[model samples]
Target: MHTQPAPTPTHCPYCALQCGMQLTPDAAGEGVAVTGRADFPVNRGALCGKGQSAAAVLSRGVRLTGPLVRDPGTGRLAPATWEAALDAIAGGLARTRALHGADACGVFGGGGLTNEKAYALGKFARIVLGTSQIDYNGRFCMSSAAAAGQRAFGLDRGLPFPLEDLPRTGCVILVGSNLAETMPPALRYLTELKANGGKLIVIDPRRTRTAEQADLHLAPRPGTDLALALGMLHLLVAEGRTDEAYIRERTRGWAEARAGVMAHWPEYVERVTGVPVPRLRAAVGLFADAETAMVLTARGPEQQSKGTDTVGAWINLALATGRPGTPLSGYGCLTGQGNGQGGREHGQKADQLPGYRKLTDPAARAHVAEVWGVDPAALPGPGRSAYELLDALGGEIRSLLLMGSNPVVSAPRAAHVEERLRSLDFLAVADVVLSETAELADVVLPVTQWAEETGTVTNLEGRVLLRRRAITAPPGVRSDLEVLHELTARLSPGLEKGFPVEPEEVFDELRRASAGGPADYAGISYERLAADGGEGVFWPCPATDGPGTPRLFLDRFATEDGRARFVPVAHRAAAEEPDAEYPVYLTTGRVVAQYQSGAQTRRVDELNKAAPGPFVELHPRLAARLGVVEGDEVAVVSRRGRAVAPARVVGTIRVDTVFMPFHWGGAGRVNAVTNPALDPVSRMPEFKVCAVRVERVG
Candidate 1:
């Protein structure tokens, strides 16, 4: 009789929850079967629809198996050898650099990449191509929350406390997050919170599944979250619920923040936001009355043009209530992508180095330079952000290397972005599938998928986890690390030390580079991570023998004076508001079955069946005004573009607002009409709110 090997424990590949799962060999020996991992603390054996269907994407039938190059004469992509593809990419990049200088070459990365891949990609861009134009899609995910968190606490780690603390907290004010749909398994924690006799206040424009579970749901007007938060602060002060002693001891700038909230009286805030005065009072009473409470924000408020200031308002509320730095109480951001927290920490961002160090800081540059064995002066400075880099594709950047992102379907003003991609002189894409963006590339290199690679990824709670390899990759597929190693060698032949293909070796170098920096990972190693029984370890572990820190800012903030800053922020209107031409508000979000961009989730039969296509969700009054029924097609026209989808007339949404999920392409692509106006500080696009006109189609 043949013996069966032990199942490998790993995490899901969908959202930041990173729900634990086990992969066992299939009976046919071609793929692996997935099951819930009960011992892991995050999810505790709960698996969502996306997690259960994740293994379906690992089949060879759905993934790209070899390299492809576009024919010069035919303009059609054809299979090619790996050597030929790499040589073509190297030649194109070199030619572009010789013609237009190093700044002409750009590198674009993704939020889902492992820490090893993100580090290698950033290093390759700065070292091999000698280009300063490097950034990733994570800029659009949680940059506003990160910028606000850093300013308020002197550190940003998505979540300051673990998920286990949620149930113990007396009250939780969840703003703009739809965890029931975006991350189903994570909703269990909120459920348990209610079960423990705790109260939940959910704030969103639409009555979503998450809001349905809340004890009090505040459906405020779109683009009015800032006003709602400021009003709550005003009510807190009126009721004398402010933690004066805690604020005096642990915080600074209280006078300025207090003065800012005075301008936003309850009546004035009620006019700007559609929420009633009584509901606002109830929300504040519930939050302020609890001994220990928390505030969490997600993409809804963080994807606006004034996202930085908007998030700052919420942070100010937390600070005034003395939530942060207290046990089981603080402000946190619900990161979207799988590695959104780690991807930004380990470089690949326009203005950061490994360990979340700023690129323009001289000491940071010198510290990282010593690890790479290069001079500090040789490294390039910061560059344009994600949207700015995409807008400058044809003019300043002639060539681009994209990895792990499908920007054509994800970026705001996607039609314009697609035209920019068409105008590029050369384009190379590295991905496991022939994504919509990869189809436009001159060269496409096939890479290994999640189950076929071994690497470390940091989750939303700042826990660094090891995803072990459960199966061998097919013949023509290579890991992103291997691709980067070969490309670095071919681009710079005379370098003494070459890029490492092994994930452990790359992680060791990453530890050395990240030591003494803000998001320090010096103490973590492959052995330490594995010994934790696949539960993973949190970051900021400075010593080799020390256990990682699961909660941060408990003793003191990371500020120079060891005090949190209270930034005074005022409410502002969205970049584009409803006007004569566009009479209604438009918002975009996700569904329960499909993930971002639908590049991988759409390929799975079960997921596709669950969410076959996109639809416009509107109030019954709006549908009746447009003379549309539940199944009738509706045309939503924005200033930038237009999209057509079937109508779903539901009373759960606001009458003046229309909703669409941004996961499909073609006529159903919602991002085509999204506003591209960026936040001055975080550079986040206004994806959550825009102006549009809806009409019934025959």
Candidate 2:
């Protein structure tokens, strides 16, 4: 009889929850099976619908098996050998650099990439391509929160405290995050909080599933979160609920922030935010009466043109309440993508280097250059952000290389971005499946998926966990590291010495490259992660034998003066407001069944059955005005483009706004109508709010 292989421990591929899971071979020995790991603290043996059915996406039949290149004669994609594809890409990039200079070569990365891949990609662009036009999809996900967090505390981590502290807190105010639909496994924390006699306050434009469970739900108008926060602060001041001692001891710049909030009285704020004064006052009372309170934000407030300032307002509220730096109380951003926290920390962003170091700093440049064995002066300066780089594609950036991201379905103003991709001189994409963006590439390389690869990813709580390889990839498929190594050899032969194909080797080098920086992951190793029994290790772990930090800012903030800074901010409308021609506000979000862009999850039959496609969610009054019944086709037209989906009339949403999930492609792609106006500080495109006109379609 043949012996069976031992089960391999890993984590889910979807969301930042990174719920622990164990993979074991099926009885028929064809593919693997997923089982929840009880040892993990984040999910605690609970798996959502997406996590339970994740193994379905690992089937060989639905995945790409070989490299494909566009046929010149037929103008169609056809299978090609690895040698031919790599040579073609190398020649294309070389020609672009030779004609338009090295700045014309753009590299776009994804938030789903492992820590090793993110580090290697950033180094590869600076050393081999010698270009600074490198950024990732995480810019669209959490750039605003990152900027605000860094400004307030002098450091940025998705969550400074662990999820295990949620139940112990006295109260939690969830701002604009629909955790029930976006991350179902994480919803248990709210349930447990209520079970522990903690109060829950949910703020959203619609009465979502997450909002339904709240003790008090405040439905503010779209893009008015800043005004709501300012109003709450004003009420706290009027009621004498502010923590004067904590403000004087642990925070700075509160006087200016206080004056800013006083300008917007409760009555004026009620007009701007469409939320009654009673509700606003009630929210403040619930939050202020608790011994320890917490505030958590997500994409809703972070995907706006004034996102950085908007998040700053929320942070000011938390600081005034004396929540941050206290046990079981603080402010945290609920990051969306799988590795969003780690992806931003270790470079792959336009203005950052490994270890969350600024690219413009000479010390950062010298430190990273020494690790890569290159001169600091040879490194290029910062370039355009994600949307800007995509917009510059046929013009300044002539050649492009993309990995993991499916921007055609996920980008703001996506139809125009697709046109930009088509105009590029040459485009190369590496992915496990032929995504909507990959379908437009001149060359497409098949790569190994999550279960077939070994790497590390950081969760929302700053815990760095290892994802162990379970099964071998197909014969023709290759890992991303191998693809990068081969491409480096073909493009710059001698420079390939430092590029390692093994994940372990690349991670070891990454540790050396990240020493002494703000993130400080120098002490984490694969052996240590595995020996932790799936609990994973947190960051700022500088010593090899010391316990990692699960909580931060206990004694003092990371700022130079050891106090959090409060930035005075005012409210502003969205970039595009509803007018006579476009009388309705449009907002986009995610669903529990389908992940971003629906690249891998759409291929799973179970997920497809649960969430078949997109639909317009609107109030019954608005549906009646448009003369559209349930399941009737409707067209939502913006200045940029139009998206058509079936209508679902409900009482949950506000009358002036409509909601749609931006997961599907083609006519159902909601991103085609999203605004591309970027925040000046964070450079994140405004995706949560845009003006559009609705019409009934036969």
Candidate 3:
């Protein structure tokens, strides 16, 4: 008698939505079958194509199964034993530190790493390599929103309120997020919001599929989102719709913010933003008239030179209307990566410690160092941000260790980043597959992936969910934790005790290190997560017996005065603008079919078949002017670099703007041309808008 085993419950490996799924062993025993888990409340039995096809990557030929070491004479990578690979990496890192000081060894991580891996990577850099040059790709994803949220509310959680509150809100002003394509399962929230008679306003340069469902779609010119938000605030004040009572009781610094908004009149803002005054008034009217409303932003406004101020402008709008802190009303950011929220919380960020503590704070240093059995003064201070670290890869930083990221295809001015990586004294990359960045590494380690390891990941809502191991990894592969453990043993003799190979052991240490900090996880445990039917627990879960906090700032903000701060900001031009040579605005983003860097998703057959390759999406008018039609090869040249792809002529985009999905590499790599102009506060690259010239390629 052959009785089938029960299905293993897990979450999808792709987006922040973290849709739940049930993985069952296949009949032939080749791989697992993925299906939506109806019991989980987040997705509720809905799964996107990416989620459905995630299992394909776990197949034999789809991913790396062995470690590889570069041959000095041949300049080629060849399969090698684990001992040889780890030894080479240890020697390289030690040699660099001995010759160029500890600061010369740089460590780069990604947003996809689990909480345990992120924490361990941070500890490895500070203790083993004794370097302060540690940062992750999450800096590019949510740092702008994070900086703005912290400045305004004194805390930064992706969504202070849960996604379940969307349908109950009276209106929602979605800024720059194409949820329909980015996370399909989340699109249901907007659909339910509309079904509940709530008005929806979408602000984007293109009338995307998500915008098509909006009651009003305001197509603002790129880099002008700041002006658009300020104009809305101006109209809210002019129409006498301001919630003076709420502002007086729950917020501060309104006078300066109001003065700033007043200077940008509706008619004046129209010229700056390319949105009409009537539409601005309509957006204001719909929002103010509603009993409860919410403002949610994505990468659109957060990936600019003024990203922090841009997000702050939107926050001012919410505060003026008395939206935040009220039921079903607030300002939130839609984080894109799988573990974007948790990745920043657990010390992977450049200036943060575990639990989102400031690295420069003496108390934070003492607490974390005590957990690791090290002196507080021995801990290093803050380092450079993501772009800055990449820029200094071969110069100030001589050797590098990278994990879970493919910066060669994802970073701004990627060609320059690639050149920097090539010039490094020695580079080691640990990834699930042979990513573009891995191709240039001196040593490559095959690590266990989502389904092959157990760890916790905090979603966009700050919910800490556990992803249980469902299958055995390949023979030659090892988990990232194991790799760190082996390397730590090689670098420092006695410090190996701090680097645990088991995920649960590493998590237990993380919990202690994070105790009493901003993103406390001391109360959370694998037992609790599993006992709760894998629904996951939210953060600020301080006490063992206490209920976790699902919503924040109900009665008071996290600031010292228990009130949100209103930052006064005004509109500004992008780093580069249209001129005689570069007459078009180029904006880059993701498509539904492919995820960031296309490291894992591109390997999936179904995803590749759907996306195929990159294409330059231009307005019909722009395409006509360039004498190019749909599928015609077009070259987009920017000040930084140039990229060529087939044309996608559509009427949805603005005539002066062109769009490109940053997934592929080689000639179609859009990031090769993206400007590295950073936001003053967040250090996020200006990926949303840059000046370029479009021409037809023969």
Candidate 4:
């Protein structure tokens, strides 16, 4: 009798949606085919173009199948055995540490790494290398939102309520997010909200496709989202629509927040934001009138020099409206990277310990140190944020171990980051492909990707999911767990006790380490996750017999007084403003067909054919001012650098602002001209708004 095995279920590799999918192996036994899984709640039977074509990267020809070590004789990368590659990496790291102290060695991680990998990488950097120079690419993704959430609510989860609540809400204010393009599957939530007779309001500098579906769209100047929010707050108060009872009972510090908004009158905000007062009043009416409403923000508002304060302003508005901690209403950030919520929770971030614990806190240090079998005093303190760490390379930091991120193509002031990377004395990178960053590495280790590995990832909704190993990895490749285990064994020698090669074993330790921290995952396990027909469990699952929490802050917040705090914030100009030298605002975002850095998605033939390459999206007015027509080569010049791409003139964007998708690399890379100004609290760069001048290229 001939029998066939059942297809393995997993999650998508791109974006924070983490859409559920099933991989069925080909009968010829070569590659697997991906299909949307109808059972998962997040994206029930729905997959984006990137999700449906994810399996294409799993082919042996598309990904790196072996390790490569730089040859000193020829100054080129050459194939090498795993043993040799690992040995070379160990030698490089050891040499750097011995010659320049442990602080000279650094570890850079990514948001795409699974929960297990993120945990292991953080542990390796602290315990094995004993360096405080560890951070992940996620610092650039949601650090501002995370900082604002923690400051206001004392806990940071992407969404306090799940995605299922969206359709039930009375109204939703979609701020600075293009869900229709970034996460196509999530756009249905807005459609469903409208179908249920709920109003949708979108705030952006561009009239994006997502904005077109909104009942009202407010087009503001780049970097003025804070002012727009303040204007709305001012209107809410002047109209006497503030939820006084809810504000008094459920929150604190409202008086200060109220006073701050009063100064920025609607007329004043109109001048700052270029959004009319009437439209602002209309937005305030829709929000205050709704029985249950929500505010959702994405990269647009959070990728600025004032990102933390900008996000805090939004939280203040939500608090004033009594929206959060209620059924079907709250403030949430649409986390961008896959596992972004989980990646930060587990401790790949610069300033935190496992389970989102403060690294400087004695209790946090003592608790996590006990789980890792280390002295509390032995663990390193907080390190620099992502951009700062990258900037310090070759100066204070000499060697770097980069995993899963292509920062050369993604970082703000990317050209400077590439220069810093080139300056590093020793660099090692582990990724599925030869990314732009990997091309400059001393050693490149090929690692198994999503479908080839079994691990856990936390989605935007705080739902912890298990991505099962659906297919065999290409020969000569290794899982990140295996790579971490081997490297730890080499670096620490006799002290390689905690590092485990199996994902489940590491996850068990992670649970214990996260037992009592803010983002606790103690109750979660592979068994519990695999149970319930693989629906996955939410976090704050503290006990083995208990059910995880789906909605948060229903009764009280995570604050000391059990009430959310209102952080007083005021609007400010961006780090850079348009002037005579750079007379236009430059805003960057994602295109529907391409994902971040274009590391993996660009390899897909279908995606490439659809997007082809990067282009400068300008308002028709700006195109004419530059004397350029559609498809004409144009150069966007900023103080940092310049990028040349074909012009894409359209009426969808504001006349004062120009837009570019930050996906492609090389001459078309927009990040090359982005500002690296750090937010005071969150240390996030001004990736969304910069000042630039456009000229037609000859």
- After superposing candidate 3 on the true structure, give the runs of residues whose Cα lies further than 4 Å from its correct spot: 1-3
User: What tens digits encode model 1's per-residue C-alpha lDDT throughout 330-446?
Assistant: 999999999999999988999999999999999999999888888999999999999999999999999999999999999999999989998999999999788899999999999
Candidate 4: tens digits of C-alpha lDDT, residues 1-698: 43455799899999998999999987777768889998999999899999999999988878999999999999999999999999999999999999999989999999999999999999999999999999999999989999999999999999988899999999999888999999999999999999999999999999999999999999999999999999899999998999999998999999988999999999999999999989999999999999999999899899999999999999888889999999999999999999899998887898898898999999999999999989999999999999999999989999999999999999999999999999999999999999999999999999999998999999999999999998889789998888878888898887666888889999999999999899889999999889867778888999988889899999999999999999989999999999999999999999988889999999999999999999999988888878989999999999999999999999999998999999989999999999999999999999999999998999
lDDT for predicted candidate 2 compared with the true structure: 0.93
Every model's TM-score: 0.99, 0.99, 0.99, 0.99
lDDT of 3 by residue, 513-567 (tens): 8889989999999889999988899998887776788898999999999999999
Candidate 4, residue 499: CA error in Å?
0.7
- Output the better candidate (1/4) by lDDT: 4
Clashing pairs in 4: none
Cα RMSD, each candidate = 0.9, 0.8, 0.8, 0.9
lDDT of 2 at 552: 89
Candidate 4 lDDT score at position 159: 90
Clashing residue pairs, candidate 1?
Answer: none
- For each candidate, what is the lDDT? 0.92, 0.93, 0.94, 0.93
User: Which runs in model 4 stand beyond 4 Å of their true positions?
Assistant: 1-4
Q: Find the candidate with the highest lDDT and give its number.
A: 3
